[model samples]
Every structure is written in C-alpha cells, then in structure tokens.
Target: MQTIANTTSDFIRVSSEIGTLRRLLIHSPDRGLGKVVPSKAQDWLFEDIVNLDMMRRDEYDFYVKLLLYFLDPDKIKGRVANLAPGTDRGFFKPDHPDYFASEKVIDIQCLLSDILADEVIRTKLIAAICGIERTSFKTQQQLTSVDPVELAKILISGSLPDRTMLFAPLPNFIFTRDIGIVINDHILLNKPAKQARTREALLAQYIFFNHSLFADYRDKIIEIPDNEHAFLLPDSDTARDLSRSTLEGGDVMMIGPRHLLIGCSERTTLYAAQQVMRLVFDKGVVDTVTIIKIPKKRDYMHIDTVFTQVKRNVWVLLGTLARTGDEARKQDVMHFFAPKDLSEDLKILQFRKGQEQKPIEIENLEDLLANISRNDLGATEPVTFIYSGNNEFPFGAREQWTDSCNLLALKDGVVVGYDRNDYTAEAFRQAGFDVVTAAEVLDRFERGESSPEAIENTFIMLPSAELSRARGGSHCMSLPLLREGF
Candidate 1:
C-alpha cells in the first residue's frame, strides 16, 4: 500500500480517490430518479415540490459540466472511456466461472476477509467465492489450507445455477457520497447506515482497494477506534442517549480538512457522530467536528439540506425555520415559513473551534441569497442562497422540502445537483456559476449510456426516488472521497 506523510496545510487538497486520486465517482440521475412519482412522491416525503421533466434536463447539464470542468482531462478519459450515454445491463453479469457453476451462494464474510487480507490476490479471491459455498469443507483446517483464488474456482465449479450467489445491484449508487469519506489524502470506505445502500459500500470498497489507481494507498483510509465497527453509548435518563452509535457519510461535511461540521440527524445520532469524531480524532483525520443538532423533521432530513458551503467563509442557506417539536408534521414546519419575514426568523448556526453560535439571520430565502454578498459574521465574504421554491413573492414551502437546497460541488465553483427548482438555477447564475442540465445525460445512464473519458467529468450522478423515497438526494446519497475548497 502507498504511504504518504500527512501534511498540515490549511487549504484542503482533493487528490485522487485514494491516497493519490486519479478519478472520482458519481451517479447520473436516471429512471430511478423519479420512480416515486404520482401517489408515492408525497407519501415518500417528496415535500410536494418538483418539475420532473425540467429537473432531468437541468440536472443532466449540471453533472456533465461538473465533472468535465473539475477532473483532469487525461484522467477523465481514462476512467470513463468505456461508458456510453446509455445503460449497460451487462454490468450485472457474473464471471466466467460463476456462469459455469450450477448454483451460487452469498458469502459476505469470506468476501470481507479476502479483500482485507492484502492486494495481489484480493481480486482473484473475490471472483472465486463470489457465488458458491463449500459444504464439504466442514473443518477450519480444510478451509484455511485452500488458496483464495483456487478455493474460489473450486467453489464455482461445484456450484449449481439455481444456487448461484446473487450480488445485489446498487440502485442508490447515483448518490455517490454515501459510500466513503475524504480525509486529507486518504479516503475511508464507510459503513453504511441502511441496508439499501450496502451495495454502494461494497462497490466503493472494490474501486478503492482493487483499482490500480488507488490500491497503492490504503493505510490512510481512517481506521475505526480499536477496530470497532459500531459505537453506541450507554443509556441515560431523560436524555435517552440521543446520540447514536451508528453514522452515515451523508451527514458529514468538511469545513476544512482538519475542521468539520456534522449534522446529527435521525439517521446519524449525536452519540454515533461523537464516536465517529472520536475515531477520526484518534486517527488524526481532522482537528474538530462541530456537531449540529438537527431536530427530527421528515423534510429537513440532513444538515446539507438546510445549509451547504459556498466558498471561503461563506455558505448558501435555505433560511427556513429552526427545526422544532416531537412528532412535528409537515404542516407544523410549514407554519414557520408562512410569515412574510420568514427569513428573519430563520437562524444561521455557525460552528467553529468546537462550539456553535448564531452567526446571522435572514427574513426569507431571498434575503439570505442577497446577504451572501456582504460580510455578516465580522468578515466580508461571499454567501449565496437558493430559495427552495419560487424566489419571488408567495413563498412555496412545499418546494423547499424536496431538498431544493441540497447540492454537491465537484470543484471550487462547479457543482452537481437535481434541477427540480428553476429558482435554484437562477441562484447559481446569480452566484456566477455556469449551470447545465441533466436531461440528456441522465437518459444516457437510464439507457446504459457511456461517455468518453474526455466527457467523464462532465456528468454527475443523482439518485433516483427508489432510495430518495427514504428521504435523500444525490448529495445525501453520496460519500465524497475528495474535496477541494471545502
């Protein structure tokens, strides 16, 4: 594995995916992006806001340009040289041995052990045991004596077609951020928060651990404390240990390589975030993590939904109400944004040096957008806002809930996002960004399209509603491995 010294540079560098990133990952919005249409959209907590056809067009252009604009030209071509602008169902095809096997078996443990052992033989071993199991080798000695690659072949040869090990496809993979976390030069393959996203974890692990571009550098993917996989705090009275023992990469953000601001949403509890912080600290991955408490609200799923970083000392805020109440319904949250001076009531919570303070306030999303142009917290910096709904009068609270504010940046000024809200595009233009659409690009993924490496960075992946039904967007679905200008 490649070994590199950790630097103390304040400007966070976004290298290759591993220790020296040569390429990155993303999900182009596809058919899956809108599987939750009609009756299910709202029930799926879609926030009653969307323009499906227009959204596709806008998102396609955004992702295409995002990668094209950020990645190195040579690197982009090398990674996506094989992809087209359409679907590739052949991705699901098994290896030749699996094809010959009569049956297959799902062996999660063996899969984990082989990859973790070391490189060289990891791929061969993974191919071998991907689908078949051995019942004859009952003794530990028999199993241990067999070479991973050989064992895999033997297992495949003995397997039956009906018993073939079925590998689950990554349906939510379009949201690439859920799979890993960028820590300086290294990136950690994170443990996912939901079973639905597990395939993404595996795919990311494969790309990072086995891919030639990243295999050399494995030491820096931040390790968990004491090699523990889970962290749960002991129960306490009154408070009920609101902190969780589990964490998802979706809730993590790097204000800087060493400085982080994380959200403790329902998927990510305070305890879990704290434990992750502890583990990160132990590994010296960051200097601090300001945990932002997110009150339970179906619409305000994650912190990124309400707030996202823009540039140096600046952010784009939704300017909605501070989350409140237990069992708070959408109607209740709507009440907060109903007033004419809704932005004034909306608070901007700042976290730096381990403490959080209210840095500024706005009367509405529009004011917040306008305010980003000036210095609010003692510093003259650029802060931008994208009103979730129409930027004009007659605020549309429902539109904000569809995650109008959630967006992922590929570089300093370029980004990838769903185009459900036109006002958001205008906001970007106002922020001086060159906006693009996802219409044709997304259709390519749905049609299994491939793009030449030169165009690889041009596309960004956005998750469909299959997983979005669970309340997340491409930004929420992805776990970034590299980030610049955080």
Candidate 2:
C-alpha cells in the first residue's frame, strides 16, 4: 500500500479506481477519423458513420477540455478566462477574462513532442516507420531530414505525399483505456482485438520505452510476448500463431491492492487471461486473479461498460446481470445469469511464485466479490450495487448502450460520465451524489467558490453529444498512469 508520494518512480502505479488521478495518457481523434469511411466503418470498429469535423470540434474538443481541467484546474481556468470574447470556449467557465495564454493542452501530440525531442528516439521512430512502410532509402533520408514535430505528425496522421500509409488512421485510438492498464508498479500494454488498433499498441510501447517520463520503469513494463511479436513481425508465422492470445485494457480492473478482475469478453480471450495471470504471479504483482466471463456481445464488449466501481462499497452495474429474470431463467443462451449457480460462470485463479496454479469456483459474482473484499482487502463491510437504469428494461438497455455504467472515478465518490444517460444520472443522485456539470464544477473552483475536497459524492457530467456516438464513456477514453492512494 504505497502512496503516490512515497512511490519512488513516476512511471506507473494504480491500485483502485476511485483514487485521485495524477497522470493520464490520451489520444485525440484526428487522422484516425479521416480514415473511417462509411463503407468501412464497421470494419474499422465504428458503430456509425461520423463527421470528422464534428468529432474534432464537438466531441474531442470538449473531451480534451474536461480532461485538462481535471489535470490542472487553476491553469486551465485562467487560460479559458483569457481567451478572446467571440472564441468558442466549449465547456470552459464563461467570460471571466479575455487574454490568450499560448500554452498547449497536454495530449498525445505533446507526449510525442517530448518523445521526439530525443535524437535517438527520433531516429528509431523514423527507421521503424520506414521499415513498416518498406520505403526507399531516399524516402528514409527525406523523413530523417524533416523536423521531429512534423515527423511525429506524419507518424500518427499518415503521409499522402509519400504514398505511405505506414500507420493507418487509428480511429479507435481515442479510447486510451483499451491500450494499457496500470497494475501495482508496472504497465501492462494491451493487445487490441482488431488490426485497425494495432498501431496504437506500438505507439504506447514506444512511449513507455523511449519517453523520459517512463524511463525509470522501462524494465517494469509487462506485456504478452505474443502481442510484442505480432507488433514487430506481423507477417511472421510465429506472430500469427501467438496472436491467438489476446487481451485488451478495457477488460481489466484492479479492484484492490492484490485483487485483479479481468473479463473474458469480446476483446479478451481465456488464454490471454491465463497468460496475464502467469506473468503477474511470476512478478508477485497480485495474489488472486478473478476472471468474469461476460456475454460476448457488441453492447457488452467490456466489463467496465457493464460494471464499474463508483465508491468504496458501491458499484454501478448493468441491471440485467445483477438479477435473473423469468425470460433469462427459461432460456439457456449462455447461462451467465444463473444467480443460483455461480460456479458455472465465475472462475478464480490463485497463484504463487513456485507453485502450480489453483482454480476456485464460486456461486455468484456477489459471493466472489465478498470473498475478495474479505480476504484481500481485509474489510467486512457489505458491498452495495446500483443498477444502471433502476431495474427498468428498455431504459436500462438504452442507457447501457450509451455507456452509463462506464464512469471514471476521479476519487472516492467523485466520478465523470456522460449526461445523456438520465436514468443512470438519477440513480447516482438517489445514491447521494450531486450531479454537477463539468462547467459548473470548473466555474465554482475557479471563482474560489469551492474545492474538490469540499464536495462530496459528486458526479461531474461531461457534454457528450458526439462522444457518446463513439460508443465509449469517460473510462474508455483515459489511461490513468498514477492515482493517489485510496
């Protein structure tokens, strides 16, 4: 239980969801959106056709604004107040000052700038891109001569002049949580389920490996060897065979210090989960690994989209999974809803350094969770569950589809989510959380009207008119590197 202050390295460490966020990794929806056409939207993993301009202006702009505000409230507030009068501040606190501060918001581009500042890293990146593109020597020379910043943009956004689609637009790269998860003191780079997102994993790996921010824990990074091989040698037979083991960050949840819950959902495979457990055990990262087998459906793609911990004891969960209905009991699609027969669905693996792996069965998710809290957390408090749509059918289905369950906790009892899910918002309100808009929270903080500490059970809602269409919530869009200890 090391606190963020006591922790020696700044690379990676996350124990619980409801800890104060310290650092994050996010990607802006830029060139990725440019590559997504209507005919190839489904293949590119987009739910519906999207206008690139709208995504950039309406969705990504606000998303970045909200994140920057959370990361540095005072700086962002001051910057916004200084902006020109007619400028669309988006969700910033309205009209306090009209000055312009030229500081750029921290995003993937900023991180890439930092990474490319190093000559060694810049050279390696250029060579890698050239190798991937199979470009000619003259083209490689031209890329080497170009400025690092422009080269980074080319690497991420792609280059039409060179006719090299080195890294195709990573449309889904906006969901940073799907690329990596921090556990204990290390980073576990995820292997995405689709080829469209493979470049994102490479980009993350390059950052953790080359960027000075993560230099302290370069060796501490953990990733499936199969994924590494696939990224480096996509055409190799070895890489192809090893690619069968797949795991995405969206499926992983670090519930406690030594308790990790991973879901075998549409994106993660059972073999991948087993492999991850072996690596964690070898590294002495956790004592137990609980695999929650969720339904393999588009709507239920990841566990976080269906279940998320909002408070110490309270969880916002999909209503349908919490209880068995007459229709479910009568049918036998996956038997995942058999509340009485938990052993059939839940799987727990116990591991130690030199011992063989042991499997344990449980009756249901509740019992499994209760045991985890008791054994791992050493707490006897009863766990509480809040339904997404208050046990309503179509409403619950609708809200879940819009990622009502996928809330990102800034700290205990403080979370950020989309405001479109009214039913879910009401549920949180009834649970003692004040549903405040991002603008309201920022305005109050800037005016010295209130501090985050002064607020209790607050649910900050982000404007997600276009973001919601991307089919990811706040949690999906962020990769938290550091969070204050709970």
Candidate 3:
C-alpha cells in the first residue's frame, strides 16, 4: 500500500492498468431491505422487497467468490460492515433526525444498533423493513394530502413498531462503481444528491479514507475548500432540496481519464451532468465530458441501455430506435442523441490534417448489422452486434422495453448476457464469442455458495427486472477499474 500526502492530486486521468487491478472496492447487500416493500417498493427505488438474509448472503457469496477468484486478497474489498466501524450500523436508523422528518424514514442508525444489540429486534426489523406498503394505486390527490416525511415515519413505525429507525435503504450500493469517480491516483467521493444514497456515499468515503485496505490513499481525495455541497449544485441554488436532483454512479461511466460518457436519464439530470463536468473541468480533472442523453422511456432510461463498447472501437450496439418516414427528416429529433460518430470513433481513426470528416452511418438494423461484419475486417479481432430480436419483425418500439440491446462486456470479445436472450447469445456465438449462461450465476447465488473469486474478466448478470424497469443492464450495474490495453 502506498500513501501520498498531496490531498489535491487528481486520480481521474490514468488509463486503467488492466492486469495490475489489485484494489477494487465493492459493497455487499445490507440494511437496504427495510426501505423496500411490496406497497412502496417502486418509490423506494426497488422493484421488490426481497429477503434480506438471502440477498445479503447471496451478495456475500458473489463478492467473496469473486475476490477469491482474483487471488488478490488486498485487491478485492467490501464495505458493508466497514462504513461504521465497531458498530453494526445500517444505512437507515430511526434515531437520526431525518427519519422523523421524512416519509421514507428507515432509521438505519437506530436499526443497526438494535440489530447489533438484540437478535429478536433484528428479525422483527427485517420483516417490518421489507413489509412496506405500495402507493402505486394511490391517486395524485390522495398522495398529495399526506406529507412525505410524515408518511415515511408512519410507515416505518407501522411496519416494525418494535425496532428503532436509523436511515433509508441504500438501493444503489450494489453498483459501487458509480459512487465515486477516479482521477489519476485520486478519488473524488462525490456528495450524492439523494438522502437514501448518502449513507452509501458515506460508507464509500469511510472505505477510501479509513480502511487499511484503501486508507493509505486518503490524501488523494479531492478536497474543495468551504464547499461541502460543491459536488451537488453548480453554484446555483445552494439551499435547494438535495433529493430533487438525485444522481447515482450507475448513471455515469468514465470512458477514459479525459473523456467520459455519462447517462443523463430520469435519475440523473442534464443540468446535473453539466454541473459535474464544469466542476471537474475547473480543476482540470477531465478534458471532455460527453453528455449522452438517455431517451425518456422506461426501457431506454440509461446510455448503457443501447450502446456498450467491447474492445477498443468495437462496440455491441443494440439497434432499437430506427428513424424512418417523417421522423427521419427532422435531423435534430432523430440524430440528436443517436450514436452517429462517437469520440472513441474519432480518436481511433487516425485521420490527419483535420480530416476528421469520416461519419459512421448505420441506416436501419440491417445496415448496422452489415457494417459491424465489414468494419472489423483486416483486424484479427472478432466483431459483431447480437440483434436482440429476429430480423423478420421490425421490433422498433418493443426492443426498448425488452432490453434487447443491453449486454455486459467481459473481456474484449467475451460477454455475459440474459439467458432469456437466446437470439443475443446466438448472435455473439456467430461473432466468435463464448457467450456464457447466467443460469449458473443465478443458481450459485440462490444456493448460498461461497468461495474466493476475482471479479476481473467476469461480468456478473444480476436479476434485472427492477433495474431493467429503470432501463439498464449489467453494464449499468458495474463500473470498470481496468480496460484491456490501458
């Protein structure tokens, strides 16, 4: 472990050293269940309130086995119990003032205390926490009459009257990669916008700053003076409610130290993305931050929903939205956010003398399918796009909701995808990739199987009903610390 004293050093610029990936951080499932329930699971940021014990144990097995596979003990780490040292603190606790004030009061602190102090309360707490009610059927008028904070308090108390409340559940903790953005050897522990995810951020802050596995690099944290909320708003409304513009790490991706591809979706705002870019640019953290707007649809909610890079310039593009007829003529609406010519494409084609006029075009699904086969010629690498649906039917609208395009890149050519996507697997196999089944992975999770394993070169495909409902895939669930050539 190496520790440097320059606190202002930037850690976002380095091209990832793929083979030397010894230190990667993760968060196993924890007290996030109390925040999710059948009735309010949708609003709580979860698709369902699962069994906490099962989820945690499964997550433990996943992270543990992954670490074992890597064979680098110090390289793989989890921050579930690491957030609050010597204390079994959950994300939500009733004792915290926020619990009483907010309708989603999970009381992570008090709940953790009870979990540690009494086994009986822990069981009851888990039940109440995961037994929350849903408001999906409530009319707008009916919902408006109840204060959100008051409703949250009532729900927590009603569900689990015996346990103390602490904090709201941290649903985003599973995707640890997005919580902090790395710049060179430094990491900026972002002050997240959502209160629910604040504890997750705090836990991450603790891991990077205090834990022996990663604490040596504390001085590398980006510390802006007198700007606690510097990472939140762009010097605009400092007093505004933080939750209104809530952002998460899953919605952002670092293409390189200088260049980035961020998903501006329902969870992350366009202004928020711009504000983040401006903040980092001012510090010379990055040169370009490409704002890839996610189409406003449940299925196409994130950038990773449609496009994902496999090797260098080679990408597995899911051709879902095809523009034809009148919609195609209005250039702005059709091609505004379309993946016409990405920066990666520009840099890879060594066009000299400002000859950057090469435009990558794919008309319909057939055109895109044809270009991929022809584009990588002379290049030994196998390249192809696995069409999510059959070519016979024009599944323009249906593809988006079905996540026909979202595939997790394992190595340069290898990938892990949904088993339900038999067509996608066949396409990849045709493209010369060893497409693996997610059934074994899901079965391993259900069986409480545990062993050390490395997460490198391994794309774990989790159950994505809730996540897919938000329009993202395993690629959205993961943040890469290493790339092949980098």
Top candidate on lDDT is 2
- Which sequence of candidate numbers ranks them by TM-score, best first? 2, 1, 3
Candidate 1 weakest ten by summed lDDT: 98-107
Alpha-carbon lDDT, every model: 0.43, 0.70, 0.42
Candidate 3 residue-wise lDDT, 147-249, digit = tens: 3333333333332233434334556555555566555555655545444555455445544554332344666565322345546665455444332344455
Q: Model 1, range 68-163, lDDT digits (tens) per residue?
A: 423443322223322333432112112223211111111222333334345445544444334222233332234345555333322322222343
> Model 2: per-residue lDDT, tens digit, 1-486?
000121344546788777777667666665556666678778778887666666665445555655566665555665444222224565321111321111223355556666776788888877876676577777777777766556666777666434456445667877889888999788898988777676677777787777666767778898885554545555564334445677898899887887788888788887788789889988988877778887667888998998887777677877666543435432332343343432243344444444544466554565665565556555556766666775455676688888899998877778888888888889887877799877677677668787766776888887676778788998998888777764
Model 2 lDDT-worst window of ten: 93-102
Per-prediction TM-score, please? Answer: 0.56, 0.82, 0.54
Q: Rank the candidates by lDDT, best first.
A: 2, 1, 3
Clashing pairs in 2: 82-99, 342-363
TM-score for predicted model 2 compared with the true structure: 0.82
